[model samples]
Target: MTNDDLQFTDDRPITTQAQDLLDRAGFAQRLALAVSSWKNQESLVISLTGGWGSGKTSIKNMTLDHLAAVQGCQVIEFNPWQWAGQDSLSSAFFAEISRVIQREDPSDDDRKLAKLLRSYSRRLNTGASLADGTAKLLPILLASTLATSLLGTLAQGAVAQITWLGVAGASALGSLSLILQRSGAWLGRWAGNLDEDAKDSALTLSQLREKLQKLLSTRDKPLLVVLDDLDRLSAEQMKGIFQLVKAHMDFANVVFLLLFQRETVEQGLWKAGFDGADYLEKIIQVPFSVPAIASSQLENLLFKRLDEILAQEPQLQQRFEQDYWSRVFQRGMRPFFSNLRHVYRYSSTLAFHCRLLRGTEVAEVNAVDLFALECLRIFAPETYTELSKHKALLTGSDPYSRQDEPQRVRTTQLMDQLVSLAPVPHQAATRQLLQEMFPTLDWVFNNTNYDQGIQLRWLVNSRVCCDEVFDRYFEMSIPEQDVPNSLLHELGRRITEPEPFTILLTSQAEDRQAEILQRLIGLVEEFPLDQSVEVVRTLLHAGERVGRKISFTNWSPRQQVTRLLRIYLQRFEQEADRSQSVINAFALTPGLVVVEQLLGADHALRRKGDVGYFDDSGLEQLKSVYMRKLREKADSDPDAFLADGDQASYLYDLNSYSEGGDEGRRWVEANVTSPDRFLQFAQGQVSVRTTHCGGTTTRTSYIPVSSLESFLGLERWTQWAARLDSLELAEDQCRTLALVKEALAQSEQSVTAEESNR
Candidate 1:
């Protein structure tokens, strides 16, 4: 069973009394001691700074227990992320502050302080919302109403007096009306109220500060309000939290501990248009960075978990025997396991692959190498893709030379380019780990071999880095389709037999052949001797059917892949079948027809002792051995072997011999004796001469041959005539008659010349 089915945790922080990080560097004790010794009413802002996943929350818990138990202080935990999308962090924080400070059966002063602070918090929110406009405008509106009331009373009195003295009061009435109008205009200008607004703004702030002082005076224990996850909030909420803690929330007996990644918090501060560094410095009086987990501590913890996980997987256990291989994995893995969470992330992900690989065709790929690949998948995926797509660079030589040399000098250089192109910022240590893990990629100390190349091919072929892979360990909201585990198990079971393998492979379409070939190749090493033979046989059959495409240095992958499989397979193959081994090698990837033809010609020639039989060299290697026999006979006495070599057309077939196309034909041409026999050899083949259609293309058609060119004579013409006469009357003999006539004319010319000589 694969470790994938086993229960595994994916990098979640430990909340219970988990001794995962066992006080490395005595960090917990030191931090707890520091917070415990703080003086009362100092009102310090201590920043617990660490990168994400570096045990910040654990440290916070340790410090909290220390403060409450030893230091005798009241601790309040404030999570700003809870108010994520809102704009009320100031109100929410003070509410938390009020809840903690207000005792269960509060004394009168305690109740008064809580009430005062609560009221102040509300007014502070209101004044901020209104911009103190209503506070300033209130007194102005009251005074304006009183003045209007006074004016009406005076106007009524004047009108009564004016009615008593009719004509005389008419002149007085005009001046009074003008005075009232001017007075009304003066009151409206006072209603602009700019000056009153400033005074009221100062008063509101002063009143809140007074209430804050009263609240602090009532508290016996110093208030330790711990603010966490400020970095997790949206911009508006983050701004509110920062402003609340930095400016509004400060008080005499309250110490605020802000816990977040400095970089993330600074980014939030940047969005809020505050000078992040300066703002943090002003608010945070004491900055305590989380002690980094040392390499030794990481190794101890990582190995403990790895041992636990790998205990069940015997396949992975095999890797530890090779000292250098084990060291390579450990050294490469060190950079990734910086903390407990990172270790969990890597181990849990690897476990899934380990489970998925068990009893599968690809299980032959070393399990430790698979783990290293998992690390790369998490940290440097683009590099992973490069390794996957271009395995040829690892297997063969001089492939990347033509592909822009300046850019592709060394593997590390290519890696640096790839890492730089990634959107996420990966550490330089990750690049180092990648290079160390894949040592056979290319270097002087890192000389890559065929074995390493084969291992790389497995990594690329596994297709192990995808969303479905991620869902195994990581928590995702959306469910993904599981990998075809049932299908995989069936393939693993069936690949051992030749019939099922052949039938299943051949039935798969051409596109699916490559994937099947990759799976079968991975299984080559893991299989028993008999099964290995079956794989070799099946793959060879496929090759013969598929033929060659995308040529390697000498042959295509059809033969190249077969070459690797058979080379490894032969170790387990029986020596008694060594002769048959060569034949099977030649015949199956579906066996090479070229080798069968060569073997046939060799067998024919050997009966008369003209050539010795070829030994058990593989198809490509044996071609050289086979070629020597043919060349020996041809050089020593070409005429003797020609009768059979001619019958076995492969001897003269250009593809069978190296650089023998023109040379072999020329040898045959030079050694011919009788004109009629040579003419028979040269007959019926079209030699084309064409005009150019383009740079590389040419016009092609058939051209007729002449009698002298074919070396036809009187004997050749007589033979053709006899054969034609023997044929059916309706048979096509026009071309045969034409050649005979030409030969007959040539024979007459020759005879006439000979008679003149007599």
Candidate 2:
């Protein structure tokens, strides 16, 4: 997919006329009917409640849209939160209502009604708005009058912020009586303007109600003023809005719709010293809460856009199975995101990172890995961090790696806890998917009783699951140089054409060549048996072209070919023909190195004890074939037989010789000439001396010097002691050498005494 497809977009509210998604729940129709039924009500308030992201705003928009289309219906949308921070909720609500009324109902009489509404708001500000600056000025005009009036009660209880710097609060209060005298006649004039009867009056709650009725006389059919986002206001603002609405309603032909989240509104009511239920029931004629989004609807919405992104990846469709789609990817990816915005977050990230990977990185990665990892990265950043930091442990790269004891029992416990960051039902499924994408530290699956094919498929299309790839996916720098698609595809084409494949890789150094081969071998494992064998043949061919500068050092050329075969053999062990073919592949080599390498395959090195991977009979057959090859080489060239018979003969019960009597004598004489070489073989460590000898060089096990002494007879033992004495040795080495030295001296002395007696 292109980068533009992956860019995250702004989450604009779905327009009310944009095909009414709320119709899925039939909320649109139900809410429309409820609003239509309230046509003749004198005054009423309705509340719509739901949690954040539960589509409260959407529902309000839908209701407004429905009402706006009806005959002679005027819908006025008032957002209190837009003005909540700018001034008092009482003044803000009245001002917004004045604006909407003036805009929607602008006839000559409606204009007069708008002017009267503005004047009524000023009266409310004078008596009730504890925070308005206009209210602050009223105390000067009505100080003594307010002492016994409702405005006086509010003035005593409310403390307006009047700084003493300029308008000193004390000085203002001190001249209150004089100011009242001057403003009395002026207040008298303003009172005449406010009252239709032209009587001087104190603006009380009863007076405010009378003023609202005068404003509503010009009201059109069922004026619905929607007050939404009330929950977005502060506690004080919320209280002020509710109080203002309660006082102003009761005028005919006016209806108020108040929208809020239940808990937030309840908390505001409780803080205001009113029982939430009691207070709500008193004002609201009808209360409606939206039902939750259904699982089917949520899934449809979530994956709708994602299907387009996946359409770009046609190869992924063929590589993954139905189980991976339904059982792993779908099951694991769906639970973490339930909302539209969350779905966008996960899908966008997955697309961007997948777009970044190219060449072998893409070819080696699994689709599910990218999908699930991006999901974790968005919804669970901490868990994603764990995956990046502990890739080897999570992916089974280091099989023996684990925390000690109690921790070992729950191998993925930390991951499990991290996995718990997702919902509970998802934990097991997510764990299974991660294990599939990344190899587990322990080959054991986190969840059993589930179908798991080879994990190789998980790495087939991408290495996004690899730690290095995971890190680079987030880097802001330019992409690093990596093996290109041209090279990887060329190598793939020569799967069985070893000559050109080997020639193609000849430029790489031995160590680098082996490393690349290991990667290729792993990548090949993801394919079917025939495809895997084809890739294996090409990888084996690469050994012939590798530089011998460090050839056969760690992964010897012969071992490189055979190591992959051993992996293949274990996987297809039931297919006996494939097993024989692997044996035949080992047999095709022209040199004796293959024999030595194959013979030591079953032995335990420095790592663990012998693992029962290959069949015992198979290993024996491999060993017998290798031994016969060695005998044939010895028969061709006597000096070519450097293998000592004692080590094998101890177990094999054979002599210290090759197959032919002449070669066996020569093999004995060769060891006899340099007994230290024989001594070195017995130690099972690296031999210090350099010589042209073909043998198994990797010593993963160490044997004792005493075992060597017991295994060797008089001629070999005498030669061994002479060399140990002549050679320079460390204190520890001298101690072991001295043991043999003492035995040789005692044998010589006994022989001398026998000669003297004769």
Which is the leading candidate under TM-score?
Answer: 2
TM-score result, candidate 2 = 0.63
The global C-alpha lDDT for each of the candidates, from Candidate 1 onward, is 0.55, 0.56
Candidate 2 lDDT, 303-323, residue by residue in tens: 675676556554444344556
> How many clashing residue pairs appear in each of the predictions shown?
11, 13
lDDT tens digits, residue span 331-378, model 1 = 665566667787888778767666655433323334555666677776
RMSD of 1: 12.9
